[model samples]
Target: MKLLEPPVSDYSTVFWDATREERLLLPYSGDRPFWYPRAVAPAHLDGDGEVDWRPAAGTGEVYAVTVVHRPGPGRAAEDGPYAVALVELAEGVRMLTNVVGCPPEDVVVGMPVRVCWHELSDGRKLPMFTPA
Candidate 1:
């Protein structure tokens, strides 16, 4: 799939940059995880909306999954059948990414997974999930 990066001008740049290094970075503030990689603090969005990038454990469970038998674009189209999943990270946040390194039929909800990377055409590494 295409690895889309937020522009440096965007607040989510930290998330994209970290992934480029093969790391999973999450937006966190206070003591909880502010998921979906938004640059917002857990509480007090108006005041201390400032966020910090923290490393995620990279271990998670598949919350949901869908196998694409035919993709219209991106590597999924070239590669054919692949699994897209919502992975619930150990940090208590869920991210939508692809599940690789196995046949798509093998992906299941509640399946254990770990972080992996797929180098995109743009030379950026995209985080993917795989059997742990």
Candidate 2:
């Protein structure tokens, strides 16, 4: 999914673009990989600018979650009380996102999930998770 507040760095721009294409990018440090955008490679990696943008499998297991009983400002009322989860992707990168397509009670730790994108009115897509 696309971020509501788009990142302002060149490296992150690649990430936003990939999300628009319905893909996820995982940052790699040689054979070890991670997520979230960073300017430098991991301390153990030996090369400069060695990080490559690779497509993620977009599948994960729910590591944690919470149900938002109260709606936040600017949030859609229809989406209130939604379950937001921390998903640990198959690549070992964890991302925080809302989990849709199931009741709040149905969301649980270790549940299998798939990445899904939602397009906002401004034409930006945001990543979300749903039960697999």
Candidate 3:
């Protein structure tokens, strides 16, 4: 089965580019960092809509996790038993990513993880996490 590609767009070019270099860049408005890069910062921020990109520490802990046994459309069932997790980064941001490089059943909440990359067929790297 073909792997899914990331949702890259004008507002997210920086993020996609960083992954290619093995870097994790998060978008910031003043001191507040947010995910899913967009044209403007979080609505609560009073600063101008402009944003800045910052290098992430690339370390986090599994805030939550689940093992997927069934694949969605276009995906293969043999890819079952993969771990999907909400990783709470040291920077205070939570990211939805897959926990790999280890057995799916072994992933647990509060387990430490570090950034890893999966190269895509289109020459872009997708960021995932592995036990630190």
Prediction 1 TM-score vs. true = 0.81
Model 1, span 1-132: residue lDDT tens:
443442444786666667778988777775667676664565643446777777889999999999977673444366677788999999878898889998899999999999998776555677888999
Clashes of each: 0, 5, 0
Candidate 3, residue 55: how far the Cα is off, in Å: 0.4
Which candidate leads the pack in TM-score?
A: 3
Candidate 1 collision pairs: none
Runs in model 3 deviating more than 4 A are none
Runs with alpha carbons beyond 4 Å of true place in candidate 1: 1-9, 42-47, 72-76
TM-score of each: 0.81, 0.80, 0.92
Write model 2 residue lDDT over 1-132, tens digit each, in one string.
222454447766777777777877778877667666577776655656567777789999999999877665446666557787899999888988888988987999999999998875555567888999
Alpha-carbon runs more than 4 Å astray in model 2: 1-4, 42-50, 72-78
| Residue pairs whose backbone atoms clash in candidate 3 | none
Q: What 10-residue stretch in candidate 3 is worst by lDDT?
A: 71-80
Total clashes for model 1: 0
